[model samples]
Target: MPVNPPPAPTLSGDLLTIHRLLQSPAQIQRRLRTIQDMRFIADQVLTQRYRSAGGAVLYEVSEPIFNTRPIEAVSPGSEYPKDVTAEGAAALAAVSKWGQATRLTDERIKRNARPGNELDRVLRKVVNTVIKHIDTITMSAVASAVTATQAAGDDWVASTATILRDIELAVADIEDLQMGYRPDTIVMSNTKYAYLASDEKIANLRQRETRDNPVYGGEVEVIGGLVVVKAPLSVLPSDDVWILDSMQLGGMADEAEVDPGYTVAEMAVQVQSERLARQDGWEVWGRRITVPVIQEPAAGIKITGTNPA
Candidate 1:
């Protein structure tokens, strides 16, 4: 059976104000996830190429095939073998918009109003929600590429004796794929990060001098050649650790004109505002667009069952 559609928003009052905040020139300040570790492909690249090719729906990539034909001793009448290249295509799918809305009641707004910027507080909340949604989507895409061997039973924290061993194993898995990928980054939940930082073996390997500020006081940034990143439990489970050749993980955005791609769009927030005449309040809504894809799944591994000390 088909699912029922959500009821439409009641559009009785005139739109008091509409801020295409995304298209605006003013800088809106808010905390956002650090997504520099991932790669991003622009929609314009795909769209332009598709249009150039008579508006094809799919963008195709062709790779040369080599070393398949064995060289044989030439006979006077023998014919040389022929080799061909392989090709694959990725179709562009519409990334649905994710949005959220909050109603600002008159009483609530008046209670929290400031001298000049009465609406700043409520607007910031809406913007932050949009940013969080983008982060969730990007992280989920990265997590999806995790390999099966790294799951639950092979817990690195549970077996303290094998913590370093597990790290090696995880890196080996990426290298073994022969995809020319090297694991340079490791991300784990805050809990697991604490466990690793306190582990006796891990502490000994830390360099005496520090180049970057520690997440937890005295926590080393690098472990086994991988830069360690502590992620919130909301982004990754406390029991899981992810090792990645970040160059292979990427993000996508829809916009006009073509330029270099970004791992995550520097800006992904847009806002629309409405005045609620009936409730003597206001409504704020926001939306963002992003598509995260792993160009090479072999470059990432996820290990679970880690103890969150």
Candidate 2:
């Protein structure tokens, strides 16, 4: 019969070591799988929140270069004729003669003067709408890039590099147009500035052939917490990612702000990818890889020497 096995040795260290030694690699991998599942859930939550916040906004900035001439101020009128006595009768007669002469020629002078032309204020609003359209196109382009890159995995960085160049060129073309616009300003109220000029002569001039007419825009409406407007470029991308990209681009004033530096989402994606790549193809046992078993401490070995010092 085989000799009886020696009694188990006592563990001198903390109880934590026993807990760690007994853990299995499969158990650790299960935990890792749970974490990955949770990360995906978190990503979905973020995406939903981003969508509900708002939609794209059209932005435009313009400097109106308009021509204007000084307006002739009208003099205050008297309610009644001035009191006259016999001593000043001659002077009053002379003034009345002069006034009659001026009034007689007023009609002829007005007929000779070129039509009193007023500034074109409505034209400026139309021009602004056009400019905003161009900017909106740029915003849509950027948004397209964003959508293409969202959830792009390892290929996103490479794809966005190309998108960045294209976006720069497109935006540059928009700014290159010399939109020489001049709008007429009108006095809507006394001494207060108003952008829309509704002067009668100005309105008639706008109605003249080859002139743009006033556009009565309707009130802005919001549906489902998003401002909805008819845009030529909004239909290019149906995905939320692209829409988000466009919105971010609209917020930025220039290309310099488009750099994808250290966003939390980006960092999280990178960390997750790195971890997955590193863990791939490795057999996980409990939480550790399988290797040579560590021998336990030897016990119950009796001394066989003849004498002990």
Best TM-score among the predictions, by candidate number: 1
Q: For all the candidates, what are their Cα RMSDs to the real structure?
A: 12.4, 42.2
Q: Any residue pairs clashing in model 2, and if so which? A: 24-286, 24-287, 25-285, 25-286, 25-287, 26-286, 120-184, 143-246
lDDT of all the models against the reference? 0.53, 0.22
Lowest-scoring 10 consecutive residues by lDDT in candidate 1?
A: 41-50
Q: Mark the regions of model 2 whose C-alpha exceeds 4 Å error after superposition.
A: 1-118, 121-126, 129-133, 148-220, 232-250, 254-309
**lDDT, candidate 1, 1-309, per-residue tens:** 665795543322111211222223232222122323332112211112112222212333222223556667777888976655455445453454666888766565434323114355566666566655655555676666555446443454554456767888888877877657778788776777767776676656655566442534556678889877766677542347888776554334333222222122345455555667787776766565444444455667877656533
Q: What is the TM-score of each predicted model, taking all chains together?
A: 0.62, 0.18
Q: Name the regions of candidate 1 deviating beyond 4 angstroms.
A: 1-83, 89-92, 105-120, 151-154, 209-220, 255-265, 275-281, 307-309
- Candidate 2 lDDT over 179-288, as tens digits, reads 33111110011111111132233334343453334345322222112222233223222212111211212222111111122111211211010112342211111100
